[model samples]
Target: MRNWEDIGYLQIGTSRQRQAHAAFERLGILATLNAFGPVLAGTIPLNIDLPSSDLDLICEVPQLALADFQLLLRQHYGHLPRFSLQETMVRGCPSVVGGFEAEGFAWEVFGQPQPTRAQHAVRHLLVEYAVLEAGGEAWRQAVLTLKRQGLKTEPAFAQLLQLPGDPYAALLTLENLTSAELRQRLPPLRP
Candidate 1:
């Protein structure tokens, strides 16, 4: 299983880079859900404004066979992005990819071999209902780890953090994802 830390380039942060990453991720999530069904377990994990490099989604996909999953993805997205899948350190896990494609957020997936363990431990910390409230420790750990491996964190995320009050608190203040529009995710609030 290859550790993301070993992948290295993940830490590179920039506005252009973050936008690419997010688009790739959105595609992956939509592809997976479209193929398999509703996600049984998953998290948006990150919402704060930073020059994000990749969007992260942690989920349990129990019923779908890998080949079928790939086929469905290809049909929907047209082709798979240039991504290399890595075997995870967790046993029984196959591989995860940091891939980019047109029309969606850049995404990374960690298919847990030991679903129970990863779900309870890493996923809990990364995807709890109050994930935004988890503070900077875990995120800092991820940032540092990626840096050690030569990756970059998004710059906008850092800029948001420097703002007064809780930077992401504004998100919590929203009653609905769409205050008026039927299907729209708002732009990140300026601090």
Candidate 2:
């Protein structure tokens, strides 16, 4: 099995050329995930240009009460950053859990009210550690469905793979871009 550190480094190296403080974030996220169960572990729709300093996360704790989850946080990591619970208009009709900022990045949570038919199907695809950790057909189908819907899969995939967002976006964006073209457009990464 690949250690989180190795997977994390691979993600950083493949996504962006620059080395950033990723291991610290990785450890923090692992601690949170182990403590909180399966939840969103980082910022979504990451900035494609600049680096993000913190992990943004959320989860649907329908089976567990909000207070219970908060208790878990207090028991493990103490006070969390400021965030709110809200429901809002969203493309996927996402259920809002709350919004908060941690470290330097913002985190939001939404407990999806009731799963839509599409979501119902997507949610049961056997995600492990937030990734499609098995059942290749299910994973592929889910990815295609999300892609056709014009949803963001790359970020989710990165989280599952334990990679940072900026680098992930960088690699995805650069796949079709030539080296010269990329260098001409994006600033050089300082070592």
Candidate 3:
């Protein structure tokens, strides 16, 4: 599916993705955060996750519903291992973050006063997915190798692409390009 909202595709994905699907099902994470419009983002969904990668769930939580959202998370997930909930600002927007470990994966639930699709994490995921699809397996392996060597997803891509300045923002610059344009702009694939 082009949209990452429906996670059914994960069931047929890589082994780690299948495991993630099972964990999500076991915890009912998306259902638990349904009211907030949760969308799974990050490396795991893209099949480039490191062994230590955590599940990143992004949600839309309006300011008025902040308390209820926090309550719901605490009520449902607080008893999970290492449960912690807090409020902070991300890109100047107020955000609620909760974390817990379940079924062998660390789960991070993030809520912002904006649409999940509009959040940077989801946007980055979409762009990164496009890059991976166009770059083929070699590019994917390069990104994974960089990640294993201690780089975050964005920086790994940035380093391979020779992108300058803030890797996060640089990646976004390629967000709207067509696949053809991306292929043209991307450096030749390396072995």
Candidate 4:
């Protein structure tokens, strides 16, 4: 599997993935947010995205830099279609979320006062990737099917695995398991 941190792999990925690469490159999304340590996190990166999935980019913005971060996003993306920026509390911490449309995709830039890799989105992405890797193509299809039924990614996985409680928190429990271990928890593979 390609390292999720490096988007270069997307160039040779599925059609949607390639389109995402083109969109990102044409818009200079990464470079524009370089100062904030951006990491693309979401179904798009994992190749489990539906037609409506937006380009989700997570960034590390210190609390003291929140204003500047919001200003920077506005300066660069405010003119795009449906541009909107807001500040809110996420998981008890301040967050800055900006959305716009560009290069044939909806883009969301999420900023939190913490490292990108340490964020819940990144961690959930890693675990989801691991589960897909362990379960193989069939499991991938299952996830897509569940998504098409209107269940969010984490909830779909939780339902499939019969997990209890909050799906997001439950999914994290499998994060440290190896492929073999994950396979044991997953349903038996179809022949």
Top-TM-score structure, candidate number: 3
Per-model TM-score on C-alpha atoms:
0.39, 0.34, 0.97, 0.96
Clashes of 1: 28
Worst 10 residues of 1 by lDDT: 1-10
Please write out the lDDT profile of model 3 over residues 119-166, one tens digit for every residue.
Answer: 999989998998988898988999999999999999999888889999
Look at candidate 4 and give me any clashing residue pairs: none
Q: Candidate 2: worst 10 consecutive residues by lDDT? A: 120-129
Q: Which residue runs does candidate 2 get wrong by more than 4 Å? A: 1-29, 35-60, 70-81, 85-96, 111-191
Candidate 1 per-residue lDDT over residues 87-181, each given as its tens digit: 44443455333344345444555444334334432433322223233333454444345444543333222332332354233323332223233
Question: What Cα-based lDDT does every candidate model obtain?
Answer: 0.38, 0.39, 0.91, 0.91
Q: Can you tell me which runs of candidate 4 are displaced by over 4 Å?
A: 189-191
Show where candidate 3 strays beyond 4 Å. none
TM-score, cand. 3: 0.97
- Candidate 1: where are CA atoms >4 Å away? 1-44, 48-52, 78-89, 96-98, 112-191
Candidate 4: residue 11 lDDT (0-100): 95
Query: How displaced is residue 118 in candidate 2, in Å?
Result: 8.2
Model 3, position 179: C-alpha lDDT score: 94
